[model samples]
Target: MKAAFLVPVLAALWPAPALSDGVAGEFDYYILSLSWQPAWCRTTGDGRDAPECQNGSGRDFVVHGLWPQYERGWPDHCETRERDPSRRDTQAMGDLMAPGLALYQWRKHGRCSGLSAAGYYAALREAAEAVRTPAVFDDLPRDIALPPAVVEDAFIEANPGLTADGITVTCKAEALAEVRICLTRDLEPRACAPDARRDCARSRVLMERIR
Candidate 1:
């Protein structure tokens, strides 16, 4: 017999949490995942209508996904696959999200967040509105270089309550990629977990400006 090489895959055994009444309100805090707008504009072209990317407007960090996370692992897809959100809920998010993502984020991370769809959207909006963008990142130069810690410091300085322990900067191929900020369920700043801390291996990285 010829030798066989098989790769293993792990399937979710539990039903969608929403169907089983969801695991709402069980997480320790919220993860407001922000993505660098330039990266998306230059790479994915997914958020074609995002306010920051429209018609030569200044670029910025936009809401990537508002995640419902436990202090450690997170949850996903708690509702029935076909669950749909109201137009009202989606509209409330404004230009922070791309089309069709409000509902997708709700089902995947909201349901497991231990909050109703409405409540989840409310929190998402709250967290996004609360953070004041650092002046440095607001108007990115053509191509600037800085250490990850510098970016972290910028945010902590801009936001009244942010701390070094509460923000994590992640990169993609020497370009700024994402910033994960932790907040309490009530949208208060909290220390990010060790797992969420930025561990950039480089001394500095190049930040690409919006196209």
Candidate 2:
């Protein structure tokens, strides 16, 4: 009886098996080899017939554009919450970076215009490091075989109801300088400001309060 009790306790105390370095290598290869996609945004309706519902409130998920607005801020010329989803009123977005593109191209040079070969090489090295290290993104039990397709699918599964394409990308042409602005003080209330009102009337980026 004592032996049976001790066995169960020992099993419960046992640590999870360590992941094999070989499996980690395979996952790393796939993650680095996968094709990188440019930033893009999209929207989806509830498939309802109601006209009001069709144009009603919807969520926006930006995969990349927010980095510029988030990491730094919006342009100085325009004082507002540049990437607030509620302000868009029509779409959301996501950007898929190429294998070595993420580190070099993300929020650098005013929005991923292009990175030099040296930058690309450095990004690749960084990608390798991300996989080996353990964190929210790191896959445990390193022996598990991971494919690029599988990783992509898993990302989708993780974010239920939200689509990946909702993220949008910006070109180097816009070339807006980065500056921080609050949604309420800088963006929301500014809607009524003379200049902001003019731009809002024409473009109407933000009209209602964004929750």
Would you list the C-alpha lDDT of every candidate in the order shown?
0.66, 0.20
lDDT of 2 by residue, 74-113 (tens): 2211222222222122111112222222322222211221
What TM-score, over all chains together, does every model reach?
Answer: 0.79, 0.18
Q: What is candidate 1's lDDT per residue for 116-204, written digit by digit as tens?
A: 77777777877888887787665565778789999889889989889989988887777777778899878899998665565556788
Question: Residue 25 in model 1: shift from native, Å?
Answer: 2.0
Which candidate leads the pack in TM-score?
1
Global lDDT of model 2: 0.20
lDDT of 2 at 173: 19
lDDT of 1: 0.66
Residue 11, candidate 1: C-alpha displacement in angstroms: 23
User: Residue 194 in model 1: shift from native, Å?
Assistant: 1.9
Query: How much does candidate 2 score in TM-score?
Result: 0.18
Candidate 1 residue spans exceeding 4 A from truth: 1-22, 46-55, 79-83
